[model samples]
Target: MNCLLTGSSGIVGSHIMFEWIYKALVEKTVNHLFVVIRNNKKPAKDRLLAILNDSSRPHFLNDFSMADCLSKITVIPSDLSNIKKQTLEKYNFSTVIHCAGSTSLQHTTDSKEKVQHQNFNVTKQLLTELPHNVKRFLYISTAYSFGIQKDKVTDTIANFKVQEFRNPYEKSKYESEKYVSETCAKKNIISQILRPSIICGRLIDAPFFETPKFDVFYAWAIFLNKYARKASSDFRIWIDQKSGLNIVPVDFVAKAVLHAFLQPNIKELNIVNPTQILHKNYVGDVLRYFKINAFNYVSERPENLNNFEQLYYKTIGVVFEKYISVPDLQFQSETILKFINQLNLSTNLGVHENFMKLIDFSVKKEFKSSYA
Candidate 1:
């Protein structure tokens, strides 16, 4: 079998690439692996090698030598946003793993709609315009794609009926799932959708608790870092101590994706942590880590706010209000559990310890990002 994968340089894609190339390629389960990298300044293979060679990367090649993996790999240089049939004609792949999409922070209708268009266009091109050898398609979507369901969110692939969405990302993914499902059905292709919750750092994996990006949970963590540092500011938060935040480490996500694409039994899988991080524990961890004294949780928004508090609401606070305050929605986990059982892996990878590791690493970096 031959496989084609996109987003080879992204957080989840990198993890999947680092450990599985040898097993898939050398073992002959997948005869060859085609990796897609958007080459701007240099060749795509050079760019992929640069990412693999970076010492600060959260993942590594391990016992799998870079040369051995590269031997059976073909680097396709083309952005999914502007896919051309001529670029992909020579390759024959039995599987297409579509992992690249817009995880943009832009919330406006234009921005969100633009993402939807780009995502849909890429999916359409991959299925119809790319080489006809693709017999299986795997889509990487977010668990939050179910929309803001206060009740239990199941792993079912039915359409989400909700009045509101937390953000445009959720909205886009929801639409993308529908499109992928319908298109794959028409094409007589086997499709598996993996909806991973908030993509996080490694826990039990070899390069323990490392991450390439600092967003989502880390975004608000950065907000609190700044909020607590202000001597005159009050550290008040609007949260229910018990509201659950669903997050899964990237390693497990990669593992789940690896397991899903190799077979055709799975239709939809919620790749989420078995146990979620509660607001009380998360707040306590942050407050204790920073030694913030005036810690207070409010059911309602504070009537009058200080300058910083106003700024907080105007910025990241407003962005993440749904997460810290929404009802705890339980993700269906039977499929994920089956995968974990088969792999002899544990979902509970010392939750608190891993959480603190993120806190420590981000704090050491002073919560920096080129995008943030």
Candidate 2:
């Protein structure tokens, strides 16, 4: 089987590539792996090699020589914003894994246009470019696309109009999901949409600084830690203290995607952890991790925050308020869980371990200085 994958340089896409290439190494089920990447300065092969050689990869690949694995793949360099269909006419692929999309939550004019083009427009264009022989189209989406609906998040497409989205990113994913489903149906294509919520880092040698487009959870944790350090008195960040966040690690997400890709029919799957991270525990753990006792989580916004605290929330918190203020929602995980069970895979759904790993990586990288 031949495959075409986009966003091979991204967080989730990198993980997917790692796993897919590993499978090829073992069983050789995939005949050819074509990676679609966008980099003007560096060649596509160099970018793929970089991801494979990164020290932060899953621990299982530490002993394997990446050179052998990297040689088995092909890379195509293109922005994909307005890719012509004729450009891909020569290659035949059985699967197309679409993982390229903007994850910025910023609300600026530039951000609005980026989210629209990257998420919605890109998917629309790719659907037209897909070969007629392609059997599977896997699209990576976020469970938050359900938006601010503090209710049950099922394994299905969300209604973009009825729900109130937290930001343009969520809104864009919702719109893109609609387009993907409609186009695939009309073309008689098999499409699977997988929604993973709040993706975190792996425990084994996870990268310190992720691409800014992704890694919102880590960014939030690091920002809060910085704010705590600069505050004179105890400070509280406003959030629904009781809300729960479904923070799943990348290894789990990658395995889930791999399993979903093999299945004959899976319309939609919520690739989320059954366990969730409560807001109080998250803040409490973060404070404890930093060895600081000056921070807390509060339901209401503090009135008299200091200059630094004011700036922190006004800049970081306000941009992420929609995510932090969200109430806990139930995620339907029957299909995904069944798939994992059938594969006999053990998944670590603990939030504390993953959170601490991220904190450690951030500290080692001195993200406080770099990001600040």
Candidate 3:
């Protein structure tokens, strides 16, 4: 199978590429793996070479050690924003995995135009203009695309009006998904969309510093530790006790995507999230893991607290306010579990282990001098 994979430098993309080239499509089935990268980014040759030379360097290096696999992979430089129709005609892509999109939650309507351009417009162009030989166009979308309904969110795609989005990123992705579905219907192209919730760490290595969602928790922990040390009194970050946070590791996400695509008749599948802990539970677990006693409050109590407690509450409040507003963010895991059971791929998704590893990695980096 000749495949076209985009977003090779991204966290999800890098993981997907590693799985597809090195593990799943190894040896015979994959004749050529064309990696579509933006020209302005790191040169594809250099990126691939870096991976090949050292797979343990913390970047997208795990797949690099597979030199035999890399030989079959070809890097194609093309901007998804302005990919020429003629250029796509050059290669016969049996499968096109679109993983490129801005995952930023802070983008405004005007500020997010470029992201929308890349996510929606570019995808529209690719599906509409691509050669007829393309069999499947797989899009990597976010679970948040289900919108901030706060109620039960099913794995099935439901129609959400444009104005209902919680943030510009969500709105843009929804718009892009709409366009892809519409265009695919018109073009008669087979397409599948995979919506993954907040992807955490890999069991083996870090994906990238720039695309750090799972790593942010570690950073937050470090920041809190530093703040605690710097502060004159007892320190704690306050969080709501009722809200839940959905976090899935990168390994499960990659495996699910691959499994969904490789399955005989399956068109779409939402990877069942194994760890959907309540926000307070999540924070409490991390704090407990680190031996930090966090004072949890059921109601807003900023007025009674002293300066240090007030500041810490304010800091955590911001993050809570942003994410807590997301509707129906709690994902259904039965589908993902069914698929995993059916495939009998390694039963250990390692969600907690991977998260703990991330924390360990950060703690080591933060206190290397003192520990050494």
Candidate closest to the true structure, highest lDDT: 1
Any residue pairs clashing in model 1, and if so which? none
The TM-score, computed over Cα atoms with residue i paired to residue i, of candidate 3 is 0.80
Error of 1 at 212 (Å): 1.8
Comparing 2 and 3 on lDDT, the stronger one: 2
TM-scores for every candidate against the unseen true structure: 0.91, 0.89, 0.80
Q: Is candidate 1 or candidate 3 better by TM-score?
A: 1
lDDT of each: 0.73, 0.73, 0.62
| Steric clash count of candidate 1 | 0
Give me the runs in candidate 2 sitting further than 4 Å from their true place.
Answer: 62-64, 158-162, 204-214, 340-348, 367-372
Count of residue pairs whose backbone atoms collide, per candidate: 0, 0, 5
The whole-model C-alpha lDDT of candidate 1 against the native structure comes to: 0.73
Q: Which has the better lDDT: candidate 1, or candidate 2? A: 1
Model 3 residue 122 CA deviation in Å: 3.0
Could you tell me which 10 consecutive residues in candidate 2 have the lowest summed lDDT? 204-213
Model 2: colliding residue pairs:
none
Per-residue CA lDDT of candidate 1, range 12-34, in tens?
87777764675574455556778
lDDT by residue (tens digit), candidate 3, 208-311: 22122334234456656666543454444445556656666676677677776676256656665655656654666665655556444444444566565666
- Which pairs of residues have clashing backbones in candidate 3? 51-64, 148-327, 149-327, 150-327, 150-328
